[model samples]
Target: MSALHFSRVVIVGVGLIGGSLALSLKRAGVVGTVVGVGRSAASLEKAKSLGVIDEIASLEDAARGASLIVLCAPVAQNFALLHALEPHLEPGTIVTDAGSTKSDVIMAAKTALGDKVAQFVPAHPIAGRELSGVEAALNDLYLGKKVVLCPLQENARTDVAAVRAMWESTGADCHVMSAVQHDAVFAAVSHLPHLLAFALVAQLVNAEDAALKLDFAGGGFRDFTRIAGSSPEMWRDICIANKEALLREIDTYEKVLAHLKTQIKEGDAEGLERVFTRASGARQKWGTARAAVTNVEP
Candidate 1:
C-alpha cells in the first residue's frame, strides 16, 4: 500500500502527545501543515515557536478542509470537544484521539457526533513520559510504541485504515480491539498503576514524619512513585473515566495485599516466598520476551 499522507492535520490539545504526533508526522513527511487548537493561547504560541505546529486556529476554523483532526486533550474533555466540533466538522474530515481511555470517548463521540460518529476513530497510543506539555514533546516518542484502535462499527474500513496508517507513519504498531477490552486491559496495567503510585506518595506526604522519610527515600521509593509525577488533572480524568474497571482491579489488588499481609503476620515464609518467586519469574519472563520482540528506537 502507498503511504497515506494528510495535507493538513489539526491537533486539538497540542500537549506532549499531540505535539509529539505533529513532530512525528512532519519528520515522516506525511503531513503538510500542522494546525494547533487549544484553550491556552500561550501553549499554542509555544508549540508554534518550538515548530511543533505550523499554525494556530480555532476548533471551528481548524476543521475546515482538514484531512485529520486529533483530540489529545484530557480524556474527559473529549465529550465537550466533540460536541463543539460536531457542528463545524466538515465531511471527509477524519477525527481520532490520543486519549488513554477508549470506551468513554467512543460514547462521547456517539452522543456528540450522532451520525458523524463514524468519522471519529478512537485510539490510544501507549507512549508517554514523566514530563508533559509541548516543551517535553519528542518526535520519537511514539517510535515502536503500541497504539490501540477501537473503531466503531459505523466506521468505514478506509477510514480505519487511514487512521492506522497515520499512527503507523509515526512508527507505532496498531492493534484493534473492542473498547470494552481496551478499557479493561489499560485499567489493569496503566490506570491502576498510576493510582497506586499517586496513593503511595499521598500516604508518604500525609505521614507525620513525611519530611524525614522523604529525606531518606532510596531508589526503591523513587522507582515505585515515579509515575506519581505525572499530570494530576489528566490521571484524574482517566481514573474517573475508567472507574468501573479500575475499581475492580483495585479490589483484586486489595485482596492480594491482604493475603500478603496475613502471610507476613502469620510468619508463613514459604507462602510469601511462593508468591514473590512466582511474581519475579513472571516479570523477568515478560521483560525478556518484550525486549526480544520490541524494536525500541533510539
Candidate 2:
C-alpha cells in the first residue's frame, strides 16, 4: 500500500505517544513538517533535539496552518486544547487524538469544536511501554499495534479516511467502532487492569511487612505490577473520564473475587481449582490468539 502523506502535522503534546508518532511519520517520509506545542518549553526543546518535531509553536499558531493536528495530552487537558484549537482549525484540517477513552473525548470535541467536530476523530492506539516522556519514544513503537478510531456522527468519510491513513502510516492496524463501545471495551480490558495493578501495589505498601515482602518479590509480582509504575497523572485522568464503565468492570471483578474468597475460606479445593483452571486456560488461549492476530513479537 502506498503511504499517506501530509504537508504539515501539529502535535499538541510532545510526550511519548506524540513524539513516537512524529518520529514514525518522519522515518516513513509521510509528513513534511511536524510542529510541537506544549506547556513545557524544556520538553518541547527536548523533542526538537530528538528530531521528533521540526519546530515549536503555540497551539493556536500550529493548528492554524497544519493539515493535521494530533492531541496526545491527558484526557482532561485535551478539552482545553480542543477549545483553543477550534477557532484556528481550517475546514480541510483533520484533527485526531491518542486518548485512552473515546466517549469523553468525543463529548469534549462536540462541546469545544461544535460544527468542526466533523473533522475530529477520537483514536486510541493499544500500545505503550511502562515508561513515558519523549525520551522513551520509538519510531517503531506502534508497529503492528491496534488503533481504534471512534468517529463522530458529524465526521465526514474523507476525514475519517485521512485519520485512518495517518495511523496506518505509523504501522498501526486501525479499527472503527462507536465511541460508547470503545469506552466500554477499553474500560474492561485496559482501565480496570491498570487499576487492579495499582491497587495491588498499594495493598502491598500498606502491609506490615511491606519493605521485606517487596524485597523478596519475584518475577510474578514484577510482571503483574509493572503497569503500576505507569504515569499516575495519565491514568488518573483516564480512570475519571471512563469512571462509569470502569466502575462496572470493577464491580464485576469484585464479585468474582468474592466468590474465590468464599471457596478458599470454605476449603473447597475443587471449586478453587475449577476457577483457576478456567482462568489459566482462557489466558493462555488469549495470549496465543492475540499474538497471532497482532503479529506482535514477544
Candidate 3:
C-alpha cells in the first residue's frame, strides 16, 4: 500500500517520538487527520498547539477510528495502552510502536490484544537524542536512520508493509528481525553503552573531589557521558525489561575493562596501543559511514 493511504493517524504519548511522527506524517501528506492521545493534558495541548496533530483525542476515542495507531510512549506504558485501546480498535487497523525494547511489548500485545496481534507491527526507530518531550522533537529526526521492525509469525504482510511505508515516508530505512535478535543486539550496542555512560558519570559525580574533576572535564568527557543525561525513568524501565541481555553484556564489558586495567598497571605500552588503535579505527569507520549516509558535511 502507498504511504498516502493511512488517512487517520493516531499517536499515543505526545512526547518526542510521538510528536515528531505526527509532524513528519503531516508534512509528508501521508496522513489526513493526525490525533494525539496521552495522559498528560498539558503535553497534549502542547502537541496540538505546535500543530503536531490535527486534534487531541482520548485514548479510547483515538483507537476507535484510527487507520494507524503508533505507540510512541515509554516501554513501561505500552501494555496499559494496548489493554485500554484493544477493545476500541477497529478491525484491520495497523498498530506499531517506537519503543526502544520489543520482546515485552510483543508479549503484552499478544496477551492483551489476542487476535489483534496480527494487526500489530512492533518497530523501533534507531534514532533520537538524550533530549525529549514534544518541545525537543525535530521534523527530520528519522531521516536516513534505520528502523527495526520485529514482526511476529502471525503478523500479516500487508500490515507490516504499511508500517514500513509510514516510516519510509519520513526517510527511514526499515529492517526486519525477530524480537529476540532485536533485544540481544540492542542490549549490547544501545542499552550497554547507556549503562556505561551513566555509571561513568555517576562515579565521577560521587567522587570526593568531584568539583575539581568536573572543572577540568573537556570535550571527550562531555561527549562520552552525553547519553547519561537521558531520562532516568525511561532508561530504568529499559534496564529492568532487558535485564538478562544487559547483565550478560555488562559481564563481558567488565572482563574487557579488567584486561585493559591489567595492561595499564603493567605499563604494557604495546598492549594498550593495539587495543586503542583497533577501537579508534572502528569508530572512525563507523563515523565515516554515518556521515556519508546522513550527508553530513563534516
Candidate 4:
C-alpha cells in the first residue's frame, strides 16, 4: 500500500479527536474517503454538517470496508467497540487508536482481534484542550504535535510503519514506546496534573468561602487550573484506568509539598528560595523543549 493512499479510513466515535483526524486526513489528501462511526445520530449528522467525514457509517459496516480504522472514543468504550467491530474488520486493515491510556486498549485489541492483533497499533496523540465534541475539533490540532505509538511485541512491522506514516503525513512527529512506559509517563505529566487541577478547583468551589476564593483567583490560579474545565467524564476514566501510576505520582507530589511546608514552618527563607529557583529553572527548560517540538520552520 502506498503511504499516500488510504482507500477508506474509518474513525470510530467522531468527537474532537476523530473529527480532527478526519479533517487532517482530508487536508493531507491521504485518504480517498473518510467514514465516521457513532451511535448518536445527532453527532453523526453534526460531524457530516461540519464536514468531518465524507460519509457516516454504522460500526460494523465501516469496519467492513476500511483500509485503516482509527478508534477515537473514550478509553472505557474502546473494548466494547473493539469486540463489536472485530468480526467485521477486513483482513490486513491497519487499526490504531487515540486513547489516553494504552495498555488496556492494546489488551482489548489483542483479545477481540485475536490473530489480527498484528494489524493494530495503539497510539496516543499528545495534544488536546479542555474541550469536547466535534465542534471543538480543528484541522491543525495534530500539526507539529507528538503522537506516540505503543506497538505490541507481536505487531507487524509494516503495520506499525504505516501507522507512523499516517501521523507523520499530518505533520506530527511520531515516536514508539512500550504500553507500560507510555501509561507511566502520561500518568505523571498528563493524568496527575489534570486530577490536581480538578481537585483544586473542586476544593475551592466546595468551600464556604467560595465567593471570596473566586474574587482572588488571578492569572496564576486560572492558568494553573485551566485543565480543570475539561470534561469530567473523560478525566474520571483516565484517573481510574491509570490509578497505580497516578497514585505514585500523587505520592511524589505530596513529598514535594511537605518539603515546602516544612521550609515555611521553619521560616527558612534560603531553603524556599532554592526550591523556587529549581522549580523555575525546570519549568523554563520544559517550556523550551515544548517549543522546539511544536515549532516548525518554514
Candidate 5:
C-alpha cells in the first residue's frame, strides 16, 4: 500500500508476534509469500491452516533468497537460529527481529553472523497481549503501536529503510535508539513491571490462603497482575537476556521499597501521601498522554 513490498518473508517463530506480522503483511498486500518456520512442526502447520502463512518451511530452507527474515522466537533461541542462517544467507536478504530484548540478540547476531551482522536489524514491537500462539494472532495487532529499531553502525541505510517500511506498513510508528539505551529503557519500564507482576502472583499462589486471597482480589489486583498471564518462557528469556539492566533496576527499586517500608513503620502519613500523590499524578499524566496517542482505553 505504501509502495514497499517483500517477495518472500520468513517468520521464524510463527507464534503471536510472527503470525500477526504475517497476517498484517498479507492484509496490507505488501508481501508475496509468507513462510512459517519454528521448533514445532504442528505450530507451523497450524499457522498455515489459519492462513497466517502461505507455506511452512524449515529454518534452513527459508533463509535462501529471503527478502526479509524476522526472528520472532524466544530471545534465547536467536543465537542458534542466526548461526544456522549464516551459511544460507543471501546478500539481498535483510534479517530483523521482534525480540523484546535487543542488546543480547544483537550480541548473538554479531557472534553468529560475524561480518554479515549488518544484515540483521534489531527491533522490538511494543505491542502484544496476554494471549499468544498463532490462534491468538490478529491482523491489526500492530496498528497504532510503537516499534523501536536499533541499527548497527555497519548496517546499510537501504536495509534499515526496508525494515522501517515493513513495520510502517503494519501501522506501527518506528523510533531509533541505541542497543544499550533500548535494553535499559525496556528493563525499567517493561521487564521490571512484568517481573513485579509475576512475583506478586507467585506470592499469592504460595500463600496458605491462596484460593481465598485470589477470590478476594479486586480490579486493582487484577490490573496490576495482568502481565503475569503472559508467556512464562518468553518472559523468562527476556529477564535473563536483560538481567544486567534489570538487576540495576531491581536494586534501585529495593531502595525505594525499603524507604516506603520505613515510612509505613514510622506511621509517616505525610511521607506516604507525598509519595502517593506524586505517583498518582505521574501515572495519570502518562495515561492521558498515551490515550491521546493510541486513542485506546483501558
Candidate 6:
C-alpha cells in the first residue's frame, strides 16, 4: 500500500493549520495537486500565492476528484461543512479533520457521511502557533508534534493507516484513541489551559487599573496569557464543542484554586509550600518528559 502519495488533496480551510498542511504535503511530494476551498476568496488567494495551494475552488468543485480531504475549520462549522460536502465527495475519497474537539466531530461525520462514515477519520494535530491565516503558515508546523486520530467504528484499517501516514510524513507522531478519551485528555491539558489564559487576561483587562497593570506586565504574565490572543471565534467554538469535558476541568481547577486560597487566607505556610512545591515539581517533570518525547535538547 502506498503511504505518502495522494493524487489530489482538497483542504477545506486554507487558514494557518490547513495552509501549513498543504505546504508540508507538497514539500514532501506526497500530494500531486493541492486544492484549497474556503469562504474567503482573499484568504484562498493568499494561500495560493504563498504556494500553500496549487489552486482554489468551491467545495463542490474541489471535492470532485480529490483522493483526500481535510477540514481545518473551527469544530462548530465542521458539522455543517461535512453535510454540505457529502454530495460532492467522489467515491473513495478519504476525509479527515484537524479539529480540536473529537466526539462532536465524530457524531457530525456519522450523521452526514452515514454509510460512508468509514471514509472519514477524525484527527487533531496538537501543534500550532499564536498566529493565524495563510500568511502565518509554516511547512514544519506539525514536525515533532502529536496527531491524535479517533477513527470511527466504520473506519477500515486502510483508511486509518492512510491518514496516519499522511501526518507521519509531516514528522508528527500519530496516536489513535477513542473520541471520548481524546476529548477528555485534551480538555484537561489543552482546552482548560486556554480557557484559564483567556480568563486571566479578561480579568486583567476589565480591572480598574487595567492599563497600568497591562503596561507593567512582565514576561510571566505575557507567557501565561499568550494563548488569550488566539482566534476568539475558534476558541469559542472549541469551548462549546467540548463544553462537558471543559466544564469538568474548570470545576476541578476551581476547587484546587479554592483550596490554595484557603491556605493563603489561613496563613498556612506549610500547606501553601506543599502545594506550590508539588505543582512546581509536576510541571518541571512534565516539561522534561515532553522534551524527551519530542527529542528536543533540554
Kindly list the per-residue Cα lDDT of model 3 for residues 219-265, writing each as its tens digit. Answer: 99999899999989789989987888889999999999999999999
Quote the lDDT for 244 in model 6: 94
- lDDT of each prediction vs. the true structure? 0.94, 0.91, 0.88, 0.88, 0.94, 0.90
Q: Could you say which candidate leads in TM-score? A: 5
Tens digits of per-residue lDDT, candidate 4, 122-173, equal 9999888888999999998999889999988888888888888899887889
Model 2: lDDT of residue 12: 87
Clash totals, every prediction: 0, 0, 0, 0, 0, 0
Arrange candidates by lDDT, descending. 5, 1, 2, 6, 3, 4
Local accuracy of candidate 1 as per-residue lDDT tens digits, 1-298: 2367898999999999999999999998999899999999999999999999999999999999999999999988999999999999988899999999988998899999999998999899999888889999999999988999999999999999999999999999999999999999999999999999999999999999999999999998988898999999899999999988999999999999999999999999999999999999998888888888783321
| Whole-model alpha-carbon lDDT for candidate 3 | 0.88
Q: What is the TM-score of each predicted model, taking all chains together?
A: 0.97, 0.97, 0.95, 0.94, 0.98, 0.97
Kindly report which residue stretches of model 3 are placed more than 4 angstroms away from their true locations once superposed. 1-3
> What is the clash tally of candidate 3?
0
Superposition error at 7 for model 3 (Å): 1.8
The residue-level lDDT of candidate 2 at 117 comes to 88
Worst 10 residues of 6 by lDDT: 1-10
Output the lDDT of residue 193, model 6.
91
Distance from true position, residue 208, model 2, in Å? 2.7
